[model samples]
Target: MRRTVGAEEGDKEEEEAEAQYHSKDFEWEELRAEVENDPSFCQHLLPFQPTSTSSSSSPQAQSDSDAWKRFHIRHSAGKFFKERRYLLKEFPELASCNENSKVLEVGCGNGSTVLPLLRGNENIIVYACDCSTETVERVKEIIDASNIISIKQRFHPFYCDLSINRFPTWLACNQCRDIYLQSQHKSISDVTMNNIMDSNNLYLLRESGCCNGGVDFITLIFTLSAIPLQTMPVSIKECFSVLKPGGLLLFRDYGLYDMTMLRFELEKRVGFREYMRSDGTRSYFFCLDTVRDLFVGAGFTELELEYCCIKSVNRRNGKSMRRVWVHGKFQKPL
Candidate 1:
């Protein structure tokens, strides 16, 4: 029902009170003065403008998108993935998928999760997408360098924004590109041609073998938090739209008052539960109730939700930092 991945002894009440105190707003002038006085503090509290003026097309939205693309390109931290062996150990559903299974890793950064899933099962096709074209290009580079025929055959990486419901059209264009590339050598596959013809229907594209089936599993690792708060619901619903009946969505993200959030000055907070990092990328912290509500609102049945708190110690610095994370698994009904 509940599990603590790692925790330290402390009175729960005291921790809650401390968290509340840290969340209170500070005087604007004082906060600004503190930020200005400390170069490091100023660097960490980079300002971020909202991505879109309105949900519909606008110059502001286009500018915001371009800003995000540039941010991701300049802030490319090398590949990183949580232990795959540990992930399989914790979520057995991942290991149990059959040969025809399809898994989609939203916000896949440089093939981190994608590569691990490919290594886990040669038969399981893994489709990955990221909002950053630069990130997608990096993932493609990693796959090409791997020189693994099976991985190349089973992995598909594309660039698309999951926060909106434009995935079907993006997938269609990607499929067309693949068809054109293959045609240079010989006859294009019938499946590719069928996908081009029925590109408008998400279900038909998958059923016709042009794309992977309504993905068996979708992973949103630290991805959803980057989206604007208002758009999170839309994004979650879109994830639901692409999942097959009984498919699972696995989520892991920062929890409220985590060490990272605690380190930020009040001025760095842009919206409710949202904070802007030094790199101009944004993050949102979540609690169990909010996470549960978000999925249930999107028609998912909650199977597991828990707060994992861990204390990490820096031996050299003789300091301890408490890390908080929320992990959940929700499934679409059959």
Candidate 2:
């Protein structure tokens, strides 16, 4: 009887693993609600919205930023990191660098990369951003608990209100602004970069020398694939616009034959090329060529484009599953 019970437990574990290997269908409203209920959800509720930093800003920009943050807080960062490891394992060059590097991670959900990278190399000042306030709070909590740095490496969490023109009290930049305005005499250089989460999209970051003249590297892990195929071009352009000349950009995301792709194909019964999740999320799977070409079109000079597949076997029917992903590294021209 004990042996039988052990076998049953093993089977259950296998099933659970298999379930995660495939995409499960869900409704967008339900998914949103699930995020709301998550413990990390509270971090995203910004007390106010940030005033525009760019000349071409509107009320909607703030709103959009807030919405993105809220969505980010609800996501599972742990799972994101698990999927991300396959792409980062071989990039020793990035892992080793410790110079005056400033990194901007656009959708830095749960700070999957920031935490580990900071642990490995201490010199980098990471400007990690996520649309989710909950996720940001969670990251701060994790960092605080670990006691990673003596001066605490300046981790800042921002709640993108997207509604108010005034910067929220919790905003990292706002904190800096309050001090700068109050002091009325300090040089910009005297301001601590660590104080703000660095919202460049809203023009909070100064264009010249903001990234120490330019960021040494920028990582967009698992985010590009989340954008719908149609909007991908624009998104890529935006990313390109932010990157300094000669700066490096690394991306890892679902490939053409990932589990999610298979599930999308199964549900649609037609090749939709671009698929949307129940939560109003969308994604695209890319072949090596497709990904390389997309980056090239966006004016990025490709360094490496590779496809990786992680295989898992189902014991029940002797079925095998492969999680496909595309990993790429590109650089802007000097």
Candidate 3:
């Protein structure tokens, strides 16, 4: 199924697209210029350079983990759920989204969008998981309390570490074993998913607590922004592992010059740069290339990266606010 743009005014949509294109243009040119002139910047962008072998494992990791705790304290997943309701209405393709059709939501917080979404559409079974146990339980409870059992009957909520685990059955069968060997030996994070069937722990006996494959679509609403830039490849690799051929992946997150980015930078709480994110979380406020590189690195093929901003003006305060968001759609090739 395909999405249709809302009637609210196509003008704003065009403007948002232009803004995104320009922002990406600016960031890429700036970074390329910097890298061409200096070598340190290039090293800084690379995940492994040995200059700071400890950088990846040190306080960076600690801060990345801690940042989630602190940020979640200020964020209300329930509220976010309510707000994202517009997504389905605005993009009607979501309304007819099937119930039995397998869908997986990474970082399924508070079960806001997914719950109501599943309620409205039947044939669309969902396998929602989050790294946070609290969030996962919240989603489970919402599903348990909902009355969409007829069509929206299946919603499996669990916690996962996003790592693939092989099964004995996979090793015993020649075909399965061959596929498994290919996946296990492939450098999934390198963006080459040629024989990816073996790379994922899908099709095995379902684990008691983990979400292991059988997904047709993945919705990464507001989750990827929280991942460190360096870890994005790993996350994408995991995402690719579970998605079926030609499966759609919908992603929406904060973009460059977003109000949140500006506010965080003005506060000077962490390092500042073109692609780097504050709070020790490796967020890259991508324009175009960075966003493209990140996904392409993960082996996602069909891609559409857009920058969207919701603008509001306070007539009384004479203040204008813009909420910048990036949405990307990619597909694992058939």
Candidate 4:
């Protein structure tokens, strides 16, 4: 009355099931390619390419310039736009700061970091800057769309290229229109003079004056790796120039041999541990020692530095990817 399968039959059934599972798992690789090819997906994946006039003739310089231009376009399009929710939690410096604290988010695309920080702490003034005007415009859009009255008061967005030494001057010269837009309901003169000056708390010195000795915290989230390797030291030194004595520089960026780095083919390898993605965006992986040297070389004392390794699993594809990132806190001496 009972049916019993022989050991050999059971083994055969188990092998068939395992084989079917493996097929599905392997199919994910093919599916990923197809998905990447989709128009909608590509729109999100690829940034807008820069015109020839906008970039230099040198292939490497042009490539890097195009990559950043594309990133700004993609950011404006709402691709890769998400608030970093862990800012206050991970960096105690942000959490402990009082209402008078001033924080600058370098490469703050579309207000992803600034908006959240503003929402989290009303007393703190957040200064955000990006190399791309398009990205800066998007940040203004986000601030306007939020409809939060206090945000207009506390958030300052500007267009600045940190790779250059004269960023402070450039930031001072550019008018922050977001505050003006918010104060449009007021008298034109009031909005033009008082409101503009009030909103631009980051620039303690007016347009005629140089920006010096005001920043309390500076955040470089995945920003330094985008700079050309040769210019990284200059960028770090510039960060030193902006911060007040004892101010903290909080940084998070890709670490060496990350899964994203490992996925690059020989052709995509543009530099040492640096790769250009299919979409033309470039990324560099960093090692802890190298990061320490770069920060220390720029006169920052390391408070904390570590490599964070995380295994992310794709349940649909049954694939696991390793993500490695470096998180650190370096402080300027008092």
TM-score of each: 0.69, 0.59, 0.64, 0.69
> What is the number of backbone collisions in each predicted candidate, taken in the order shown?
0, 10, 13, 0
Per-residue alpha-carbon lDDT of model 4 for 138-257, expressed as tens digits?
888887787665777677888777766345643333332222223434665665576556556535544445442357899998778777666788888877666765789999887765
- Residue-level lDDT tens digits of model 1 in 70-149: 76576565333322333443456777888868888998877756665776666788888988888888777877676655
For residues 151-245, what per-residue lDDT tens digits would candidate 2 score against the true structure?
Answer: 26545445432123222332234333433233333456743452242333324444332223334566777666654454566667555655555
lDDT scores in order: 0.64, 0.51, 0.53, 0.63
Between prediction 1 and prediction 2, which has the larger TM-score?
A: 1
lDDT, residue 215, candidate 2: 48
Give me the displacement of residue 226 in model 1, in angstroms: 0.6
Output the TM-score of candidate 3. 0.64
Kindly report which residue pairs in candidate 2 clash with one another.
43-133, 43-134, 44-133, 44-134, 62-162, 63-162, 68-131, 69-131, 69-132, 73-132
Question: Model 1 reaches what TM-score against the true structure?
Answer: 0.69
Error of 1 at 75 (Å): 4.4
Measured with C-alpha atoms, the lDDT of residue 263 in candidate 1 is 78
Native RMSD of candidate 2 (Å): 15.2
| Candidate 1 segments whose C-alpha is farther than 4 A from its true place | 1-68, 75-77, 80-85, 147-149, 169-211
Candidate numbers, best lDDT first, in rank order: 1, 4, 3, 2
